[model samples]
Target chain A: MDLINSVTFKDLKAPLFIAWQINSECNLGCLHCCEEAGHPMPDQMHKDQIFNFLRQIIELKIPYVALSGGEPLLHPQFFEICEFLRQFNISLKVETNGEFIDRNLAKIFARLKFRSVQISLDGATKDTHERLRLRGDWNKTVSACKALIEEKVNTEIVFVPTKFNIHEIGELIDLAYSLGVWGVYTGKIMRIGRAAKNWDILCPSDEEYDVFFAVLNKKIAQYDGRMKVYYYPYDVIEELKYRLRYPSASLLVIPNGKVKLIGPLPFICGDLRKHSLIQVWENYKQAWSNPKVVEFAKKVIEEPWLVSEANDWIELYH
Target chain B: MVFTAHTKIREEKFGAVIFETLKEKIFITNRTGKDILNLLQKGSTLEEIVDTLVNSYSAPITNIRNDVTNFINQLKDNSILTR
Candidate 1:
């Protein structure tokens, strides 16, 4: 099948990918967490509602679904939801911190055949990793990697480059490669959520970012096909362009069941509870014409800093 | 030369999407490239491909032959085609 064909402007009724924030609950309060998710929010959608939404997702024929959040694994019915998604042959990807993954959980993931499981590993050692992750234990993450690799899970590591861990980028990539991971995704920390409050400390300087990418590009070229390494915002521009061409290419379903284009952007397309997924999709399509969304797109391209400042859009639009 | 067994080609509105599953590489082509790929999939010979394109398009036979040959050689280099 044509992979690019899957991404087109012709389809407004279906989205190419859905970023489903299962719940705003996480065990670790990482310094760079965009959602600032730690405790389980009371307003999260219930199990039945999520299942109903999944049914709508299948009916709409969405090709890919990324289960994200503070951490999706913390959801009470996480496995049940994965099993349900599997029944419909939907491609699944999960974003997690890797702390919850043990031998048993790794086995479950392998058996389910997830397209990819991206685990956050910000630093090479406990001192560096825990510095940003706060409650994270580097040893546990290493053990989780071993377990997942043992089960032959298609595992990938996510490295959020910050001032605290910027020096360890090379070491971290080597570590991920040694752990038998299929890919390593590293990106500059966006100034949002908890990171926003600590931007001065957490954000790397422009020169630091340029140096980091230079080294990362060399490493990626050297490794070639052995393991893939991607730098975010840099890599995401293509996806953003695709979204600009077809505004409905992505749909972010928040913890409370409200859909938005990019999570930080304040535009509410529709609430899953009140509207069917199809109706929500139509609302998303309608959003492209909204003067605010159009303006936001223009500003995003011209003023890159606006991406880091979520609330700034609120001020500009509201 | 024949298209590799692992290569999968799909026709798209703009052109064609060719995937080499073994290499996990995807290539997109223009309308003429798509037509060339379609002919290759049907096991057409190099000369036949040139002849077909010459008939379908307004291009001269000599130019069509050169382009088809270059295209096939490029695909072969990329491992999308094999003997």
Candidate 2:
């Protein structure tokens, strides 16, 4: 049948999507931030360099781009970058903390017609959310969602299921639905960034995660496509399945513009500044065949804890 | 007639995935359907496709012809296969 769909993993000649981390800068000090991003990093790319990168991405004709960071909106020229990328007809998804999204920002996003803006909303209540996100203001986030929804900007919620907010999974979904979000995405807290330091406090126990997933599954069934609910690490299984059907399907770009096979893995394919998009992609594909990378991928699959211990491995290897 | 210039096809285990980049549409088809598409990709005519399928498959010629016709019509309707 004629299915109106975006580019699938199988259709891509190179990488299907690029997760572009504009900068390692975030306003809030979230305990579970995988990048450990809070203050603006000194090495953040200049506006001109970002524009050049966007031009190269367009030239390479990458179909999908996910703008992320400490907070992508924190980039001085965030809207300018988005506008530049829009010129090349790239489908865009922005991941943000939602604090920066006001009525004006919502209008800008609606005008741009972005694919979706995924905002983090860890809990249903202020206390629960702030417990993990630290200085996160619940009302501001709620208002941002409402404004985005009202402006008809495609909005999604990201809820990282941690010990503090695991019990609030159902309530969070209800809250997202009430805010008229298109989806609610959640995943296990990876042991990276500040989360690695606070693993004992932040990481949920196996049983806790199991219970949380069960609740999520039930809610997904209840919603039944009224709203989308996605859980990561678990969803990585779907990626593995897709890989079985079509080989060579994913890539990750860190804040420093280095291409990696996985976010946590220290294996660097190539730096975007030095290499062309195709060169970086070829390097990534080549790394997939490297014995070290292959073995690492295998080990990560076999021992899930390896992902949590990625920072240590990176230090040892890099 | 041939598949549109914007359309690209990739073989999958169970079927083939057809992507229309212009419209951003994806079409997944069965092996038999994929077989037809493979032939069409190299600029095969309806008669040629039917003849090839007759040789390759055990189905009755009339049934194969009817199915191929319907499939081609569907592709055309979807602007996947174009003149």
DockQ of each: 0.08, 0.11
lDDT of 1 at A28: 89
Lowest summed-lDDT stretch of 10 residues in model 2 chain B?
A: B17-26
Superposed by TM-score, candidate 1 places the C-alpha of residue A266 at a distance from the truth, in angstroms, of 1.8
Q: What CAPRI class is candidate 2? A: incorrect
What does the lDDT come to for candidate 1? 0.77
Best by DockQ: 2
Q: Model 1 misses residue A183 by how many Å?
A: 0.5
Provide the RMSD of all predictions against the true structure, rounded to 1 decimal: 5.9, 6.6
Give one digit per residue, the lDDT tens place, for model 1 in A36-146: 788887878987888889998877666567899878888888999999887776668899888999999999998987777888898998899999998898998888888
Candidate 1 C-alpha error for residue A184, in Å: 0.4
True contacts kept of each: 0.00, 0.05
Clashes of each: 0, 0
